[model samples]
Target chain A: MEIKILGTGCPNCKTLENRVRRVVTQNNIDARIIKVEDIMDIMSYNIMATPGLVVNEKVMTKGRVPSEREIHELLTL
Target chain B: MFLNPTKNREKAGIRKYSALWTGILVAIILIVVFVRFDLFERLENGVNWFVFGLLNLPADSHLASALEFFLYDSIKILFLVFVIVFLMGIVNSYFPVDRVKNYLSRNKLYGFEYLMASLFGTVTPFCSCSSVPLFIGFVSGGIPLGVTFSFLITSPLVNEVAIGLFVGLFGLKTTLIYVISGVLLGTVSGIILQTLKLEKYLSPWVKDILSKAQHEQEVFQLEKQSFKERLPVIWQEAAKIIKGILPYVLIGIAIGGLMHGYIPQGFFEKYIGKDNPFAVPIAVILAVPMYSNASGILPVIQVLVSKGIPLGTAIAFMMGVVGLSFPEAMLLKKIMSWKLIAIFFGTVSLCIIISGYLFNFIL
Candidate 1:
């Protein structure tokens, strides 16, 4: 599985990235997590707010950080 | 499909809270009525009495007066901000950002689009740091650059928190003027920028994004939730906002209190007072580099007004600080060319200055 976190390195984006990292390690999910910091690429995802979570090229959430449990569910699924 | 699990339990929770929520709703209404009927005057008097009569501090002392100012303003302004944020939070849950974005992209409102955009700017709660993504989203979504500009301009300048602080500090009349002027400033600036046909000034990065296929439109499932189900989330959001801004509010009030007690009457009047023909422009210019949120700046503005600065100049400074900050410029720099940023800032600054002069002349 592939997960891309889209943001311009805002604090919220960092928080989301950290949460995603923790959820992945704790759940032992087999997924590659990538952070997209470039504004151009982030906009391609069509999210108006930062800290978007894209799993398998599909946007799971945008503009807010999801809980760890939510992230685990998103990845495991 | 999403993280919203335990649907049955959530529904049950909503049912259980309905009665308690009703009581909360009634209490809120009663408090609004109480605040409306000049109850703040009584509160102010109580503070004054506590400071002067109970504390036995001489009214003439600056320390006593400053303490009184700080305590009264902190309590009154915090309460006012909480009420405004809570009410706006409920409104926000109903009008989510995705819905607004979809609506803006899907419809053509003739000339009224700019007005609609400006109004959305006021209601949307995103901070200045989020402006870049929003700007990119709107432009790439095929919304006009001008309409996007309207949203970007007013989003920071006018908001519920700012309104609450304005009402707390400057009263309803000035707050109304500030809000009307802020919205108009955004609308007018957007219209003017749109006519300039400055699309080429956009960075190559954005132009590249514009050429790509637009992403699939997704409807937000969260928006379909009933108000009762959304109530707990709204309360949590409102509380979070209050907690976030509490420190700024206190520090601002503290600074304002010092000025209120220690600054001699007519001190600021000697320079930026109404008699100074250039005060408005100076205030606006001085405020551009210094960035602070509305909560931090409004208390200082209240003190400045008390120090004999004209209301228009003070308000102009407040708008400049909130709207045309260096940090916002730095963020926008990632997406826009220097020339574009200059034009955007220059136009907004000019509008603010003109409004300042108008405000001083009228008020």
Candidate 2:
């Protein structure tokens, strides 16, 4: 599984990175998490807001950060 | 759309039209009542008193005065934000900036095109930090490098909130100078950069993004929509704008408000006054590090004006704050290399410092 965290290192982005990393570690899922920092690259995904999450090249969520349970559900699926 | 006269007089029936007129009348009456009663003033005082009660501080204390300014300015500035955001939604619904961009980008006349682009930038309302998205759109629309840079520079620097604050705080003459200088700076810098042929400095992937053949083009055919049909769309856009930007507005005003009441009077004059020849460059250099939304900087500017800073120096400082924001530069970094970003910063800073000293000398 490929998970991409998209942001430019704002506080919310940092919080999201922490949350997503924690979720990935606890779930023991075989997933590769990529942090996309470049504005052009983030724009290429067509997400409107920052702190976006992409799974397998498809946008899972954008703008808002989700909870731990939500991440787990997304990962397991 | 609010602009369709036909929907109001001809088709809506006498009863509906009468109701609309009645609504208008009532709104006018309420506004008159509020003004006559000085309700806004009363509300401001009420907030101040409430803050005093919460803190149990003396009415004449510095802390109390600071709290009052903070609360009052935050709420007042935010109210302006709401009204401007709503009106911009309605206006954009009719004018549709992207269409204007599409048509205007085709103009080969560099100087005139840059002027028009800068004017449009002033009209298009943004809360703050929205230059990158518009930059993407302009670049993708095939606008020239100079014209796009002019639009990008003018858009963020002379927004609705900034202009509104300028007019309210500094009066019409200063506002006029500001708008002209801002547009001039944008135009000159754009022409300079374009003449330099620095397109190679852009991140190469920008081409890939432009050529990707994927942009959503489903602008609702507003010309076809009945008046009733467009109302909800305007409302939705306004709501989206508020939801997206209110937090930034509130936080910005909050910080600015604190600075408003707390900062000592004559602070600028002591440091970067007209008497101090190095003030303009020093003020410009100081502004780059203190990043805040343009709105956040408004209250501070308010305090600056009240502090008797030289007009040119203060405006130079404001230009510095809005034009030289660190985050904004960083955001642009993804699309351009460090060198280009530095040039962009250096060009604008030099322009602002020059304007500062020029305004001081002239005005």
User: In lDDT terms, which candidate is top?
Assistant: 1
* Model 2: pairs clashing at backbone N, Cα or C within 3 Å: none
lDDT for each residue of candidate 1 in B1-363, tens digit (9 for 90 to 100): 575679866875675456456646865886888768877888889999999989999978999989999998999888888777777776666566776777777776889989999988887886666889888777766788898999898988888788889978888898899999999999999999999988888888787766762533654344345656767766776777788789999999999999898899889887777878888888889999987567887898899898888999989999898888898889999888999999999999999999999998899
For candidate 2, lDDT tens digit of each residue in B246-295? 66666655665566667777776776667789878988998876665555
Best by TM-score: 1
lDDT of each: 0.84, 0.70
lDDT for residue A5 in candidate 2, whole number 0-100: 89
Candidate 2: misplaced stretches above 4 Å?
A1-77, B1-64, B95-97, B108-110, B125-136, B164-177, B205-268
What's the DockQ for every one of the candidates? 0.63, 0.13
Question: Could you give candidate 1's per-residue lDDT for residues A1-77 as a string of tens digits?
Answer: 99999988877789899999999888888889999998778877878887899999999988777778778888877
